[model samples]
Target: MPPLIDHTTHFIAGRWSAPDTATFPDRNPFTDEVVAQVAAGTRQHAQAAIDAAHAAFPAWAAMPPGQRQRLFLAAADIVERRAEDFVRLLAAETGTASGFARFQIRWSVDLLRQAAGWGYRPAGDVLRSDTPGRFAMAVRKPLGVVAGFAPWNGAFCLAWRTVVLPMAFGNTMVLKPSEEAPLSAGLVLAEVLEEAGFPAGTFNVVTHGPGDAGPIADAFFESPHVRSINFTGSSATGRMLAERAGRALKRIVLELGGYNPLLVLDDADLDLAVNTTAFGAFFHQGQICMNTRKVLVDRSIADAFVEKLAAKTRSLPMGDPAAPGTVIGPLINDRALAQVRQRVDEAVALGARVVTGGRANGRVYEPTILVDVPATAPVSCEETFGPVLIVQPVDNPEQAMSEALATPYGLCAGILTRDAQRGLALAERFDCGMVHINGATMAGEPAMPNGGVKDSGWGRSGHYAIEDFTEVRLTTLTQGALQYPV
Candidate 1:
């Protein structure tokens, strides 16, 4: 057996400090075994982390751009070297299946490499001066301290995304990872950065127990040293944080819940559409914010599409995440499994027909497909965040687009059609931030402007995130003394 890893101390100010509050067992969702002993951080720890980041900000921000670039590159290399360890940790800590774990590792490496190039990007733009003998420019400066809250579902990649770009742009960060994935989500990044020779206090991580996030969030919002906040989680939590951030007069970037849609037009390739819908709706057990929650198919092809998709969903393997053939793993906890059960049961009671799987085996909810769900069903409108796919027939392409737009969520949409021009035309009508033609809704890249609109939350990720993490200042130099009209 591999040696057990211990993560019972918080990484603060470049040192491991035993928690003042307590230590909690981070358990494997699949086996119910202790994966690690995680430190339970208090509000004081959160404040200390913020203070350390604030103290480290000036030197990190002022360091030569080349140096920052080298550090990011080194970190990427470290992540690549430790890929297997990350894969194991992800499975043990967050129930991440092998395929998704590998994807996370690759995406994290890409994010780090992309962040390395950010240091060399143009930091300011030269502007044409309106006044003679004057030079004017808009300079982007790093925010002093950034507070990041990363979720457990996409622990490694999402956590890396939360802090990497902002830190690349020269801001120091204090990350508060989800209690369910403290090790994989936050402390692992801290380890990589520390090994990559990041300075003391440049990146800090504090872990809290379940239901104890309030103190840490309070600390983040109440502290004057924290300049901005970035969060990835449920829409409800995002709303609460947005309100708090607003009251505190701090800038915040939120990537919240998504009821993403997938449209299969009449002319869509049936095989491709079925495969895309199955993968988009069931991959990672449909826990991803970009997972297809609602599939709108043209009535002419709806029956065929649903039949193929149901077969595909039923064929997916569900078992231990660490197993080579497992495509579906246990939910994060019993609460998640219960929520999935409640939603599917309620929908079925309200006239939804289960086309395929709709039962729970322990912590794993079977990959489910539903049809004829009523509009009033909770599963019809809200995000199920499980392996539940709702297939609805649309009269035509126009009705499909209209049905897709009925939701408050505007995170992402996918269009599967053989006609490229038709797909493009339909893509233009989506209110989502991202629309994929001939692809699954589960899409992301290091450089893409990945985000959402409407109730899915505001702001963007990837290269666009720099704008949210930094501030712009207008600077001007006068070649001669200014003439004042008195």
Candidate 2:
């Protein structure tokens, strides 16, 4: 094996190991500098990690919950002490603003702490039994050898969140982090797990350089030992994985593509609406799965809303994430940059008007706004994972609601209005799983249920996350024998 570069190593069976395949430089999206050399991990590497997890599962599950809790708390402390370092690592690797990077670290740490506390809680329910002298209940048990896929977008937050809950519930996981942003999987969570004294193989990482995730993912589906799968990525990719999971009879969770919508009503506070919508559309350079892809605004207030949004977007700084006040950073890689440019160009050709800021400078694209874009345009319907906002005018509340729910992808939806009652009513009509009432459509807390319906996500976050990581086990105890079957 060749000499591994900094930030390049896989954590398997509790130790850092070298990759078997060739390595590639994982570049910083902003300056195109090689932040780390990542391993182009193969299916064998993936299976080896899975094998380790499978070997470790019985011991991990048998360990006392309090012991597990204490270890997790130790891990949380270690992470909190050096939280700023991980924040910097996240921004450099993923082109996220420093503030957002801090948010990711803070949330991830909180999630770990929260997972630790789950030890005190019961995993399932005790139910009443009809038979005399019988006890019946359902308990949640760890699903052995989980396979996790973390996408490039929100790598820091999603990657750690995926593994934390599973590990907390005593399930061993092998994570296949995205090649574009894989360092955090090893440097942050894996390091914490090792330091906190997790037994060998409790947590594992398999990172591949660009275009190498497919084989590893396939191996995950093919492996009978992998009892559960957790994936976060594009809907197109999620479908293929879901199919494989079905064939393999493995439990699966997929958080996929989204065309989330933000509705700005005539009654909304214009300033707040503009700021929220702008942030929703452009935060992390619009790389989020929950970004506001389509904005359905009341025609009476749409003009002013769009104008103010454009102005606010212009004020957001776009450059090196290390610099102070750089709100907008570069896209993940060349493919993302080119996709944004192509979508905007195609939308313009479809008669949309670029209000301002349509320039793409290498990996960095300025936060942009498009007006008069047809509601049915490709950019309007598709997930344009870029810092561009497409605005469509609607005549009334009914039209706005109709337009917002028309998309095939239903991850998240929101409405801005002063009437709390009406806002609640309107929000309930959204086809998506999550509804935001004057809230930032793109934002979610660690404590909230983070997954979506339709193409947004199959499994959930928060309390439900534990349920997904566990399989139900029902135990019935009876004295003597009950009556024969009915």
Candidate 3:
């Protein structure tokens, strides 16, 4: 067993405040062993974090952009140096398999490096003026005191994503990480920033127990110091937060749930399709928001595709996340396990064919594939955050696209076809925010616009996030005054 981690204090104003008497246990999902004791902060702590960020905003934002860039670069180096420790921490806190943990680390490093370049980009642009001898320009300025909520599924990567870009654009942030992964998703980030010599109160973190987020959220929504908010989590939670943010008249960016789809055309490479589907449906046990949930295959290739995918799913290794060979690990908790079981069992009872797995072995639910699932089944329409895939046959490409657009989610979609032109044409028709040709739905790049539409939520991440975190102000100077009609 690894040594237990103890971080039972809120990080406020660049220092770790005294430990909170009320604490919560963070457990290893596979073994149910307590991995760390995290502080359970109250509304007061949340307010203090916001206040600290507000106080530090002007100086931090006023600093030279090049100096800020260097700090982010140094933080990236620190994270890279502590890679092994972070791998273990993720496994212990969130049951993240070695491959996924490493992927998170790699992307986080990339994100930091990418964010460092933002300082060099033009913050605004010159505008044409119709009046003679007039100069006009539009400039971007950071919003003050951004409030961020990070989810646990992609703990390390999402936590970095939630705050890094905004901070890079001269904004200070107060983060509230998921209780289930406070150390991996919250304090570890604080440690890196501290080691990199970030200014005091430039970033703050407040953690709460599972059912205790209400107070913290209330504080974030009600505080006048909080100018904007960002969240990565379920759609249900995002809706609640959006309502509060709207009432408070604050701007918000949300990356919520997704019932992503993957289309397999008849002319697709069968080998590549099967390989991509298996990875997309089962990676990290399908807990990712981008995980493929529905697969629409041309009727002629449906049987062959299902057979190959089921075999591949069954062959995946599942066990302790600490093992490098394990591909599928335990769900976050009993509730997640129960939810998967209930959805799979309910679908089976409703006459869906279970092509491969439909049972649980302790905390690990086996990778499951269902064919001919009824449209009315909850698993067919709802976002099931587990290792489950629903397959359906479509007669033509039009029907396939129709089925893909039938959902409330518009996060992302994938198309597998031999004809790149046809794939691109179809990609253009997708109402979602992102589409990939001959690729899996689980694809992402740090420089690309990452976000969704409709019920999947609005706003984008990566290079595009700056637009949401900053305000545009137009300025004009005239050489001579002109007569005005009053």
Candidate 4:
């Protein structure tokens, strides 16, 4: 039987509100079956949600930090208690494996707890001025109404960063989730928020069809009441959002595309390198924004690494994402599957060899590995965003960093080296946002700063989140009135 999921309304102003527009079907990627019908919100609905958030801002932001902290954790606890249902829906709608779905939900809960800690954190710093009797200080203030656009993959994490952070920082938010896999996670959180005693207008959600992004984008970008926009998606969309939001002088935080590289040094541990780096490529079927796409192995170890990596890739269970012990899940949709196959086919045409799996059955693409891929091949250079790994041989550490930097994206990179000093040095030159030594690029450390540079988009995660959602106000006062120089 199909997993039960019946969310068909927008969670607006702390209520289950129906959309004015027609609804769309949320289909299971693997089964190609309709799980539920989801409401498709329009520009008018987005504006209404923003208006509600605008109305709720003052009261919500004025509430005590401690109160906000308590409410956030309360909502988080609610979600945690019902993890089983969430995990099932997550797997069903988003094509996330049962284990990964659980991880995504668990990680979101953990991130919520981490966000709650920031409620009590210091808002700003007091400064000592050079001039006598001068009092100077910079304080953080909430951006009144924040508009958040989250993608389908990892809806929980994106929702927490995009909406929950704004609420935790005392601001109100209007979140618009991707229509394909939007309902369950967003609706659950909204219900949890209401049950946790949040105000009616404190947080709102607007779901729309994937084809309906233009109207929603226009709504958020053109709205004067929306103080900022937080987006996590493709570079094309992020650039569009940045350009539109910049014209209106609204703050923008984008976590965009990533063609992350994983380098295996000649002296690295073969077992550790193959296992961890394969995890990076195959995790979430490489749908993660921070997944490792290019695997650069030293000439001394390239053949050995490929042998082990191929065996590991062949071992990954592919089929129903909801099944136990399955790691390789379906692509989010057909286009995603095509993109993966196109990369592999193109690489093969250009003389790259497929080490193991290289075919797709509907949305399920086998975990594939291609060897002898040149640096310029599309598979190695482009963001495949699938469970496909392209391994290239590098002469040395210098060559590895040079090739990794050649890509237009700079989100995350993985370096596998037993030498601590060498790994740190290479990390400094990788030109990406985060680097994990001897680990996969898929790890998201909530306690530490995250995000990327270059085309990967600006802004950081974690503590940088507060700055993204809040504005810093500086004020300096003198004890007495000073004479005018003019």
Worst 10 residues of 1 by lDDT: 1-10
User: Model 4, range 50-91, lDDT digits (tens) per residue?
Assistant: 889998989998998788888888878987987888888888
Best by lDDT: 3
Separate clash counts for every candidate: 0, 0, 0, 0
Model 1 quality (TM-score): 0.98
Stretch of 10 with least lDDT, candidate 4? 1-10
Give the clash count for model 3: 0
Q: What is the C-alpha RMSD of each candidate to the true structure, in Å?
A: 1.2, 2.4, 1.3, 1.6
TM-score of each: 0.98, 0.95, 0.98, 0.96
lDDT score, candidate 1? 0.91
Model 4: what TM-score? Answer: 0.96
lDDT of each residue in 1-486, candidate 2, tens digit only:
222223477777877775455778877888777887777788888888999999999999989988998888888798788777776777677887887887787888888888887766787788898789898889988889888888778888888877887787779889988888888755567877777898989888888877667788888888888999988899988888888888888899888888988888889999999989888889889999988887888899888888788888889888888777889888888888889999999888889999988998778899989988875567888899899888888898898887787777878888899999999999878777788899878768877887778877688887668778888899988988778979
Candidate 1 regions off by >4 Å? 1-6, 19-21
Go through the candidates in order and give each one's C-alpha lDDT.
Answer: 0.91, 0.83, 0.91, 0.84
Off by over 4 Å in 3: 1-6
Winner on lDDT between 3 and 4 is 3
Q: Write the per-residue lDDT of candidate 3 for residues 1-486, one digit (tens) a residue.
A: 656344557899998988645888888999998887788899999999999999999998898988998999999999899999999999888989999999999999999999988977788999999998899999999999999999999999999999897998999999999988898889989989989999999999999998999999999999999999999999999998899989999999999999999999989999999999988888999999999999999999999988888888899999999998999999999999999999998998999999998888888889999997999899998999999999999999999999999999999999999999999999999999999888899898777899999889999988898889999999999999877897
- lDDT per residue as tens, model 1, 346-425: 99999999999888887888999999999999999899989999999999998888889999988999999889999999
